[model samples]
Structure formats: C-alpha cells, structure tokens
Target: MLTYLVSPDDSALDHYPLLGNALAFWRSTIQQRQPFCPACRASFAEEAQPAAFLFATAAIAPTSASVSAFCMACWNDLPPAMIEREATRVLQQVIPGGRFLDPCEARR
Candidate 1:
C-alpha cells in the first residue's frame, strides 16, 4: 500500500520573490480606495436641501480610467453632448470627474 501526505508551509508568504510580488498585488487591490469629489474639486456638505452631486459606481478593467460626479445643478446645466446617457447604468468607479455636467446657479 502507498499513501501521500501534504504539509502546510506559510513560509510561502516570503518563500520567494514571486510570492512577495503576489502579496503586494493582493494588498494593493484590497487596500485600494477611491474618493469622490475631493474637497479641492467639490464639496460634500449640504444645507436646506442644497443640491447634491449624484455619484454612481462601476467596475472597469483598464489602467487609465476615470469617473464623474453630477450635482442636481451640474446635471441640469450640462450640454446634451456632454452627458453620456449610455453610461448612466454604469457606476462611477473612479470619481475624478470626466466630461463633467457643469454646475449652475439656478435651481431646477
């Protein structure tokens, strides 16, 4: 009779160079964070039902990709050409604002 046995080795955590890079890749993905409407670009504060920048999210696979946010004011002020309705179903994965909808002073 013949038998096989398996042993666990956590040393793989740093057992090789390839293993190190793999750990970095996993950490990068899980630790990754994307903030929307950075204070430098927009405000998150609101009062008296002030307009809000609507945000959505989506999963994308690309090195150079971006996302946009839209306030009720910005949503209305945009030119028809700027708003990509086709992407409406898609969530704003990378909130950096691309093809903005523009903001307006008037209420809708």
Candidate 2:
C-alpha cells in the first residue's frame, strides 16, 4: 500500500492528474479552517502530519472532483478499493458535479 502525505505546501495537482481544481477547493477549505477528511471527518492540524492512502477510481471526469484523504490509521487498516469507494461517495455529497478518477489513467 502506498501512503501520501497531504500538506498545504505540496500541490495536489502536481501529484495527480484531473485534480488541480479539487486541490484548489481543498486549499480554500483549509484557509477557512475547515480542512477535514471527507471520509473520516478528521480535522487536519497544520503542524501535524497526516497520511492518506492513494488510489484511483473508475469514473472519468475532466477534473479530480474527489480524493480520499484518510488518516494514517485508517489508511493502514482499510483496503485501497474500499477507501476509493468511500472517498467517491463522500465527494458526491460535498462537491457539486464531482467525478472520480482512475489512478491507472494518471499521467506518468
């Protein structure tokens, strides 16, 4: 399993395709002091390091409307497929016109 460290300094777009706008949205959320994992509802602390399990979805969209940001414990306990499904579901609830992206399709 691969783990991704989500930080404000790292550009989500740079790591994943079709996620530039979504990262922007997350940035805005963080700025508002509302940065929380859509799946776990765990708040993010600026000084704390949070880890996420990265996976791809099958849905095709112009932009990465949703991403699974799991806490380290959750990321370690859950399967990648399950995490992807859950993240996709949560994104649908929080974002309008959100779609899932396949990690297999990401640019190399």
Candidate 3:
C-alpha cells in the first residue's frame, strides 16, 4: 500500500478523477472490469498471480485523503515517505476528498 502527503495548495485534487471518498473510490474500482493497482498499474487478478493486490488510503491532509491500490511487490518496496506512520498523523487522516485515476483511463 502507498500513502501520499499531498498539499491542498498543490491542487492535488485537480489531477485525478475525484470519487468523493475512500469508500466511493473503492466501489468504483470493483465496478471496473479489470482494475489495476494505481501505484504500479499492475492488473489486479487472483492472489496467486503477481498482479494481485489491495487498496489503501493515502493521507492528503488532516481531514482529507485519497485511495490507492498497490500490487504485492510494489507494496513491499514502498519508500519511507509513502509508508503511513504516526509522525505524519496530521497528514494521514482518512476523511474525504479522495481522488482516483483509473488505470484504463490513464492510458489515454
């Protein structure tokens, strides 16, 4: 899993297709015919496959965050900055304003 510490001033919300919140974003992913990990763009399939993975909420602010998917390898190789921790508690709240850039749509 990966978490992002985005600045509201950075206009991070403007870059992605906002899905309201974490729950909505995840639901949208499930509706997708072939969902991919947002991090590595790996196609999500059965657990035995390398493309298998799960989702996590990225912390954007004290009251805002976004949802992201991560494949097994990508999740294990995440850098320190992307890992959720108490030090960034203020920026790690899973409140609202979650954005999701569909991997399929991203190809365009």
RMSD of 2: 7.3
- Quote model 2's TM-score: 0.44
Give the number of the best model, judged by lDDT: 2
Candidate 1, residues 13-64: lDDT per residue as tens digits? Answer: 3553433443345334432533223212333233111122222323343232
Task: Report the CA-based lDDT of candidate 2 relative to the real structure.
Answer: 0.54
**Tens digit of lDDT per residue, candidate 2, span 1-108?**
122335434666476754555555655676476565555677664532346533333444433344445665556677877776766566565555665655677554
Q: Estimate each model's TM-score.
A: 0.24, 0.44, 0.30
Mind giving the per-residue lDDT tens digits that candidate 3 earns over 1-108? 234433223344456434235434544565474655555556654341222212244334234334444556655677645533222332234434333445599679
Best by the TM-score measure: 2
Could you arrange the candidates by lDDT from highest to lowest?
A: 2, 3, 1
Model 3 spans > 4 angstroms off: 1-32, 46-68, 83-108
lDDT over C-alpha atoms for residue 61 of model 1: 34
Q: Please, what is the whole-model Cα lDDT of each candidate in the order they appear? A: 0.32, 0.54, 0.42
Q: What is the lDDT of residue 41 in candidate 2?
A: 70
- Which 10-residue span in candidate 3 carries the lowest summed lDDT? 46-55
